[model samples]
Target chain A: MRPALRPIVTLAPLAIVLLGLFGGGLLLGLLQSVGLFALTGSDAFTLSHYRALLNDREFLVSLALSVWVASLATAVSLLLGVTMATALHYGSFVGASRTRWQRTLLQVPLAMPHLSLALVVLHLLSPSGMLSRVAYALGLAPEPSAFPVLVQDAASVGILLAYVWKEAPFLAVVALTMLTRVSRDFDDAARTLGATRWQMWRRVHLPLVAPGLVSASLAVFAYVFGAYEVPLLLGRTYPAMLGVLAERRFSSVDLIDRPAALALALAMSLIAAMLVWVYLRLARQLVGERPVLF
Target chain B: MTSDSASPVILRGVSAAYGDTPVLRKVSLEIDAGELVALLGPSGCGKTTALKVIAGLLAPSEGEVYFGAENVTPLPAERRRAPMVFQKALLFPHLTVAENVAFPLDVQRIPTHQKKLRVAEALALVRLGDFGARLPRELSGGQEQRVALARAIVSAPRVMLLDEPFSALDETLRGQLRLLVREVQQRLGITTVFVTHDQREAATMSSRIALVLDGGIAQVGPARDFFTKPESLAVARFFGWQVLHGANGNWLAFRAEQARLIAPGGDAPPEGWLVLPAKHLFTTDLGTQRLARLRLAAGDEVEVEGPLPYVAPDAAVALALDPGCIREFPADAPATARGW
Candidate 1:
């Protein structure tokens, strides 16, 4: 009943639930990846599945594809999101009530379910879909078949399109929060110091918002790197995203592939953690003493 | 580059409104080049609005602003070349002290070597030369404000607008920075407009003080003129005078320091001096002076400031007010009348 023990007692139940569910699952995943689980019919830990995955060309190709898709999507989304947020912030202050509604309308995509957004992209950008029909009608394409194969393309353009549409709004909302927190005095100071509007944004406003952008962009990158539904619906069959390949291998008819699937999942988690670490280090160097999430 | 080409700023009946609320109304004032003026007033009196009007941050709903002979009404803040230091330091959190000081030069696209040299000089002028590499959050409140001052002056601006730049600091630091600002303004000879609610700050820091009342300037002259001869009863009250009624029904006002304490039943003061009977209520010791609250026989209260060792509470005393220091306004005169 001591006062110092009160907070610990209050948090005990939540901690127990988290440790029981998350920590227990993580331990089980690690054991299964090392071939120590009951399904592997062995108590001895082994790295044979990981070794096989390292040499397997398909797994390596899937890993590279997931990295490429997530990196490109995150980078492009960050640029677009920061630009949109800055523009919205500047525009929203003019006719405050009307442009406030405009800012709210831009957040419609943030509420959308990822799978639903992926399906929407697939329906509109497919070779035989709405865009192709419009292109053919306008004589830009001779037929629906002449339109490029955007949906389920080998380069994952369709998946990238869906992700950018979904996650850019997420980053934009975060960026807008940062932009609004900056005081108007700083902007006035910059302007009075002879900075043009563009220079003020570039030198002062952008640096102020970079901390929030860097942290939020890392979240988007990690999410897209390990996300499942969008890539499965929009990606090609041969060089699939790691998430898609891992799920397929886990559910295969041959039970021996289960360990390899677990290992690949572990690898994805490791890479995401590494990416987060690298990002935090770079952000600290750039932002100087501001707390950056790892 | 000609010396006489720099325009003295002139505001010809400038007025501004926010939505339907009128903040400044038909306010006109002229400021000469290389002069430091303080817009002194209570909060919400449009002191800051006037400063912003001159800085081109706020466009007047009516009237025009001229810098020297050129109409600058349409110019934006970025084109005005007048930098401002805000009430708070408002140093950019992401930038180091050196970078913050160099911001104006960067905006001007001045060469890097000159920018570095000027930044160093500005920092040194603020006595913060050793702290330039530190981030703003790493510095103390006073240091942050010093850095902001450095940043404001580093561009060698044509004019400087200071909006209560030292209001956030302690009294001692405020006085020190006030002196620093005065020295820098005199040394650089940049036309400066400082906005402050503190009368003492306005008096100490500015060559002339403009007393703002009810959205317009009531009087503009040397700081001594405001204390010695306020033009109206409102200006007297704004200067913290406790107005007392004379025998003839004229309103009499004098500063706390203008009254001299006399022995109870002592010989009368010199000719033309008004001797008032009072009872001491209480006194507070300020380091160099004692401030006593005294009530006259007619139930009017007045504050008196004099040398230390104040009389005991509830003791009978006499206050001799110099007729020269007493400003009288006729009973029927309006608050805006020019009462001397």
Candidate 2:
């Protein structure tokens, strides 16, 4: 629209890459005639391999833990993220003060990758880490092992912390960008109608930005749920995340676990699709608005 | 000055600034109980700023605001009994039209049935009955502005502040809404402050117009007098029409309707007449009386409201005006702004 974008016409050539990868994989599945390599010329379709996924304990446990972590992380981050966004957006913190510094500090976490950040958190919270060493120096602990392992703890607080630290800033950025679409006049109008600052934010700003906040939380949920590297580097030994479990199954000595591994991958994809569908359904029903009070 | 004592809303020496830049200077005015006064000025001339200060949205850097003779300068906007109608008619996007008008009642914690009845009455007063179920998106621009007006009035506030509420509407709709505003104000008799960059609209609706500049009132008087007697040259220029100058350079003003065609070297050039070759610039064929804009030899463009006569672009013409039709005063010697 601004006329300066004419040079980006070259990027249209990249459609071939999209068609090659995703389109090629879909075609491979479409061409399959349900095990043509069988000794008998069987003309039957079978979902026996997909149905076999439910009996596996590791896959099921991994699926539950991933959901547990993703839901916990998303809920906690959204609460804090939306609160911070509304405060910074509406509060009286203008013109070269400490608020600008705080905004800058919040963005640094977002600039770093999630894997690097997990390692940083692990270094600080591990038994021989900074917090433990400090406790030992203060004579609060008798020895190094006396301090309980905070990193990769059984409660998954460590994983929750890692997700919140990386994803809250992401949510905040998405929410703040969406906030500009709302009218400031609504806040002013609300105040004139006898609504206090808290009331205005609760009644007006929160409801208006709820859709954006939900979408942002969904975005964070999708990433934290399926993340492979971060969970692999900092996950527990017994109940691994679904991504790590799937990876382990793929690298097995024999290819006997292929069908089960594909089932797990398909399950994770199905959950993510449900989250997206929920967002779309909510978006469709967002037409009704509340009237002003006289 | 004595009549101001009866006013419900009063501002005394109010000054407001943003950071180091002052938006409104020491502005003080009083709105008599059940009267509507238009705070008129150009965009960014501190008109809306004054409205905000009075509404308790912004604390004055100096002076005080009084509602019912009680100092309310320290109060927050929520505590003040003034509801503002913003320029864009900022209806809550999540609320229905009925709910939008009922928002203040909801905040005040009124009963549900009462709110419904009040919202219905408010909607009907704006001639928007049964539009209560519709969203703001479903209404036209004029209708949205009316909804905003309804919301403000439904509060039954002691004072109402409207900041350029009809600016978003087209010209014809704007005039129709202006008349509607006057009719509504007369019926309700609320102490209203209407802020606008339009002088004609202000004169059309309000009982009086406060001509503001530099964050202060330049002149406050009857609506008719503002067009007749502008306090200074700056005030005169803000209004689009002319301040006519006569022989010996006395301050003079000629009414546009008094302008007429004249014969060359007529018996005696009338008082307000300045004979010159007129070139027609534009003409509109209004159903009742067609109007035309013309520029004289002195390059002064005047909008004359009368029946269109035989006149073409670049045509040589003469003007016959009466001296009695013009108002004049002695010029200020130090005022050297010329050819501006």
Candidate 3:
């Protein structure tokens, strides 16, 4: 084989599997959503499914809910993750054994599956769950019924909490990796330049960690936006997350609603792609024109 | 821009450790106001740690640091205002050169116009006036270090710390930067503490050299004193002095250049010169001069450098030492004499 072609040939098998599985499924979904490749009806391309979604208030409400949940979850996770990583990095002076224990504890959340985490969130935040019971037992509340509705509510607080709990540790690991790669001398330099602790965070730590944080946040946001099981287990019935709504339509008894479901899935993908673009642009500004995405 | 007249820095009986491993042990030194002192030592000898202690970047386990009359041991690095230039340029990669130079002022929240003026003045001081708009990545290694220097002094710090700031550069660039640093230090008259392992760099750049050995200061004095009057055998050895044991627990030390070789069976009638018998082991050509290696009768190996002495291998020779060049230390003397 030619030298230049060797790398291509070596990579071809993995590329084939990824493109065939993911790309092929996406292409099929796109065709079905546009009214072509229909399983039962005439396979003719049309935009009626997407047009119907634009006019449907239920779909619009679900879309807005998904955006709201995902945005809040991602923003809170990123903030907490960056703060946690910075604390761990600087707190290393507290002694190696304690720092090691702290780091190990942070990874405990990352080890559990998201489904298990969502269930855990349900058990902890439900009206009659451990927290409400404890609150009542401590005389902070009159009873479990008096506890605020957190799960299966219009606010989607349960789903957002689950996402943050599951994803913040992952983001912290990402940001920590970048933090360790940055030399401690930079911090020393900043300190010697008379930067207070807050100024160090704003000027040095933030910019240095932004690229990794942004990349990891894009992943978290996209995953939370389109995830199905957590929202299904925790979200409100009246106005569901986009993922739950799409799954409901796809699984409905009527076959005619399939195109609308596929269209909703495609819309979720479009929104994720647009968000990734915006994140990449913001990452460029934060990291000083260094190519972050590529 | 002139800083507040420089404050004398003093580290009194400071000791520090990393985990359980002690890095600096009761190291003490004092610098006059406007004096430049180099903390000189071999690698891992705690010179840099001492510099960090003075800069307030590392808290000493014991003892106090003072800036003039103020006890600053409790102050953090940010409040100390002793800016340090590191071995690597360590310029903030995200900021342009001007922003990096202006960073100290920005941290102090100096007004915009004064910040701009000082940044420009610092860049010009480092001879990088036109390069302010470029990022750190765009500058060469030497230029990056220059920018780091500019950033260090831009705040008009009363004292500066430099930790091997030019060791990464090539010899030519190192020489250029050494001169540049010395020039700027003298021009500003800031009390500066520089850390370095290179003797020549320390000698060339610092008004005084503090020789650190193990975790303690061996000796601190004028550069010429280190060469002529080392206080201990260890200090003499560190400066490449050939030491010989003498009677009554005395140690004689002299440099390689101070020894002269005389032909075997030659005259030995010098009044004050000390002479030892030796065998020529070999000769090494050092371009400008040739070094003749010899083993003395007492089993100590020493090298003498001069125009090629006609001594064949295994040929017996007499080594004569100038009494003026010899320093004596007691055999029981500690490795570091602290009071010196």
Best by DockQ: 3
Better of 2 and 3 by DockQ: 3
State which candidate, 2 or 3, has the greater lDDT: 3
Between the candidate structures 1 and 3, which one is better when assessed by lDDT?
3
Error of 3 at A69 (Å): 0.7
Q: List the residue pairs that clash in candidate 1.
A: B7-B68
Candidate 1 lDDT, B1-340, residue by residue in tens = 1123334778999999878898888988899998899999888888899889888888899999888888989999998878888988888888889999998888888899888899999999889989989988899888988898889888777778999988888999998889898888787787889999999999988888988887888899998887888888888878877678788988899999878777565567788899888988998988889888889988888888878344778989887899888999787755542331
After superposition, the stretches of candidate 2 with alpha carbons farther than 4 Å from their true spots are A1-52, A91-93, A96-98, A275-294, B1-7, B236-241, B244-250, B259-262, B265-326, B333-340
Give the lDDT of residue A97 in candidate 1: 80
- What is the lDDT, from 0 to 100, of the residue B285 in candidate 3? 89
lDDT of 1 at B51: 89
Per-residue lDDT value at A40 in model 1:
47
Report the C-alpha lDDT of model 2 over B11-42, residue by residue, as the tens digit: 88989998799988888898888888999987
Error of 2 at A77 (Å): 1.4
How does residue B223 of candidate 3 score in lDDT?
A: 91
Give the per-residue lDDT of model 1 (tens digit) for A87-183: 8888876766856775787799989999999999989999878999999999999998899999899878999999999988888899898898999
Q: Give me the runs in candidate 3 sitting further than 4 Å from their true place.
A: A127-143, A282-291, B19-26, B247-249, B264-272, B334-340
Candidates 1 onward: DockQ, in order: 0.77, 0.70, 0.81
